[model samples]
Target: MKTKHYLTLADAEILMNRAVELSAQRSFNMSISIVDEAGALLLMKRMDGATPLTAHLSLEKAKCSAMSRRPSKFYEDIIRNGQMGFLTLESVTGMLEGGEPIMYEGQLIGAMGVSGAKAFEDAEIAQKAIHDFFQQIS
Candidate 1:
């Protein structure tokens, strides 16, 4: 058997908090979701004023990222590149943006997703959390 890194509850909480802080700092109410390597939710938060749908979208985004092992944007780009058929691939969703996998020491530990503002803005918040998360763990 081989050992692998994974996100602990403490790490998930830290990532969730950082994502929330970044959203608040930018004055954007957002829903943030964190998922383990298996795409199972570990934490989720919908900030004040965020749209109701954002909560669900964020979770899907995190799951897609974790399961795909790539940023959601990667799939978006594929669809944009004339593979619109990518949408029908039921194995993934949340392909618009805002999904990011957490990597540490070359291992995929978990993933994060954010929603509420523009797609790029959502992705930015998730990226911030991923960065801060690594700092905390390192």
Candidate 2:
């Protein structure tokens, strides 16, 4: 038998709260999404000024990171470097940046996606939130 780690609702809430705080500090209105390792949405939030499109795109970015076990930006970079075929793959979407996989103790537990700021800024918010979440928990 093998032991596996997964995210609970409490964990998701912590991540969300931290992300919201970070966004507020930066004066960014963001749409945030969290997803399990299987790319299923667990939690989502669209801030007051975020666009409706950001809500949907945020989830897709989380799905892409969760499903691929890599940052969504990975796909975007490959595509930009001439791997246009990545666009045809149906396993993932939201290949633009801003999605970050959540890993704990070398185990991939989930992912977080943020939108509304610049693409790299969105990615920074997610990455920083996840980093802070781990620090608080650890």
Candidate 3:
């Protein structure tokens, strides 16, 4: 049997903390979600001032990234490029942006998603948090 790398609760906490810090620094009160490789939610947070809908959206985005093994923005881009068929995908509900897959040593471990800011800003926050997470682990 082959060993598989997966994210633990501690890893999820690290990602959430980093995302929270970055969001605060940017004055963005958003919702954040961390999900395992299989698209199961590990942690979720909705900051003060963030809408309730953001909490749901963030989780969906994280699931999309985890299931697709790619940034959620990838689907968004495809849809923008006139690939309407992508919208029919039942597995991915969040396709706008802000979802980023977490990879370690080329292995997909989990994903992070953020919402409430602009789409690009959300994506940026997620990316930064993942980057910081990797920095800490490295």
Q: Which candidate has the top score in TM-score?
A: 2
Misplaced by over 4 Å in model 1 are 86-93
Query: What is the TM-score of each predicted model, taking all chains together?
Result: 0.92, 0.94, 0.93
Per-candidate Cα lDDT values, in order, are 0.87, 0.92, 0.90
lDDT of 3 by residue, 1-138 (tens): 867888999989988999999999999999999999998999999999999989988998999899989999998888888867634554445887999999987889999989999999999999999998889998
Backbone collisions counted per model: 0, 0, 0
Worst 10 residues of 1 by lDDT: 84-93
| Candidate 1 C-alpha lDDT tens digits along 3-70 | 79888999899999889998999999999999998899999999999999899889888888998899
lDDT of 3 at 138: 87
Q: After best superposition, candidate 3 residue 74: deviation in angstroms?
A: 0.7
lDDT of 3: 0.90
